[model samples]
Target: MPKNKVYIFDTTLRDGEQVPGCKLNTKEKIEIALALEELGVDIIEAGFPISSPGDFKSVSEIGAVIKNAVICGLSRAVQKDIEVAAEALKTAKRSRIHTGIGTSDFHIKSKFNSTREDILQRATQCVKWARNFTDDVEFYAEDAGRTDNEYLARVVEAVIAAGATTVNIPDTTGYCLPHQYGEKIAYLINNVPNIDKAVISCHCHNDLGLATANSIAGAMNGARQIECTINGLGERAGNTSLEEVVMVINQHHSLGFYTDIKTQQLNPLSRLVSDTMRMPVQPNKAIVGANAFSHSSGIHQDGFLKDAQTYEIINPEQVGADGSKIVLTARSGRSALAHRFQKLGFQFNRNDIDVLYEQFLKVADRKKEVEDEDLKVLANQYQTATV
Candidate 1:
């Protein structure tokens, strides 16, 4: 088989905005949509048109303005929703109306109080109605992580036959393990007869803190598109982080799958989304974290001083983050101390470095973090003692 290309479908404006208090107005959504295109995202899920007048307007305006990316709108498995979504996306240079219904037994019993036959019938009708507006229709099986594999395969086949160009298997509640999610995609691949007609997409949440892991598993199992949001911002736990998924594929190109994301833009893109959404990414979060490249430990600092690859897998520059900081701390070694002193315009001999390092360690033990002033003061004291 030829190498598969993974399409990045960004849902930051749709599912991401669904997070309470993270709602963005039309201007904010447009700003994010443009950034997504510049970041090389293939499709941007602009908004859910039928949910509110504001949402419908934003989706329409975004469709009108964004020319490079495939602008999309989300809708439920209802005729009205599909009509509204299609209308919103009609002006897009490239458009897709995503329509679907929940297929899990829990959703049928607790949410809709409907039977399996009724659910499948509704799902099939939505796809067909969406196809009436445009050829680019994507059908999602909401909460597919818990839906029976056999029935899910049936829905996949029905939607494809109904003219869906893409099929999304979403772990709506983030309930499945990585291996289980992979098996679900594989099951559809093996059982669905018309699966080849549509692209397989993965939409996993972060309720279990495994959204990125599950996405990789789905891709490894044959998914061609990965739906994500910046900083994993979404309802409840969150969605997969766009930077995490893109960097994973870049780092492991041996898998024979690649994304269109420009890796160097990951950091700036992350900051842009964070500022627009008013969502602060944690310092320890992977990829775009503040401390991802900073080193303070003696052993790690020594290795990093010799070669960054010894302590880091991905280079900070590769993701647009500033290079590693050889922090001066209680655990910092002699080389780190010397490096800091040299930057401060002081060159120390081997003996002077040893003395200054001992003093720096004691000062670091007192302060949580050492400042440049502290280093300079220590250097002055060392010079005075020698005189």
Candidate 2:
């Protein structure tokens, strides 16, 4: 891949399914795995093989069938976990074993009850062990957001020297501000002696609603790959939203960064993940939301009617949306009213609109929203009354 090309590491099946009650069967996992592959994701984190038998089977089956994308299985910094990840990725045309340990002091002392030295040893050892299976090994410094930058750089250098081809810096708790996260990535890029030996990847969470921002900052600083879940689905608030990040890069051409994702497939893929997982995408959610292309406010609708570019920055078709929407509501202005009426085969001149305004306001006051059916009835009644 070119230096400017960002690789999309999709962890939808692994992290996305962590949403409570959003589990998928092996067949369902395969369905999504295949879709992700067709969507041109560079890597797919199938699942954590050591977490459950079903997950192991799903990862293994996904590895067996996916043709282009690298199939990855997550594991802890333990021999058995790495072994299971390797076993699960055996059939992949391209495979990766993603293994790592928590690096933040909070997780090191409270969660692992281990010293910094011990964790460092585990991080390198896991990479070395994973190398026995394949040359594609990614070491994640879980919770690196809060980890001391100097210590984080040390850990990154050690893992790269120990044969890890990709080093992941994850904001596990989503606590870092955008500048702070970007600075951390910059520190690693400038400080790590062997940094160029491995690809720097960002895996940001959304607890504080900054995952997408933090991920972008990471890329701007040095990280070349982004680990994201579809629709921002993951534990707690969720991971970085794939569609948001991709579109942000696309819309901001001056950023000079690009990804391999097919922009048009974003909406279809978002809906697929939502439907299969039974997770609802908020109607106003960015990118793939149902109302992303809809306009109802009077000013916004009037601007959109004259020219979509007035109120809309992105062309709806750019992300596969059918078209822009001018929804009729009490807040709608004459332009929107005229636009929708014209769509339904009605034409009204300036005097006619002024004449209809009184009746339209009456219906608008009576109902919460004036639908096309109601407007048609109003138009017919006006013709009768005038006749």
Model 2 Cα lDDT, one tens digit per residue, 1-387: 333988999999999999998999999999999989877899999999999999999999999999999999999999999999899888899999999999999999999999999999999999999999999999999999999999999999999999999999999999999999999999999999989999999999999999999999999998999999889999999999999999988988777799888888888989899999999999998999999999989899877777888989999889977778887777878888887778889888878878887788888888877888998998898788888
Candidate 1 accuracy as lDDT? 0.91
lDDT value for candidate 2? 0.92
Per-residue CA lDDT of model 1 for 236-322, tens digit only, reads 999998999998999887888888888888888889888888788898888898888889998988888898889999988899887
Per-model TM values vs. the true structure: 0.98, 0.98
Number of clashing residue pairs, candidate 1: 0
Worst 10 residues of 2 by lDDT: 1-10
Stretches of candidate 2 off by over 4 Å are: 1-3
Residue 65's C-alpha lDDT in candidate 1?
87
Give the C-alpha miss distance for residue 296 in model 1, angstroms: 1.3
Candidate 1 stretches greater than 4 Å from native: none
Measured with C-alpha atoms, the lDDT of residue 74 in candidate 2 is 96
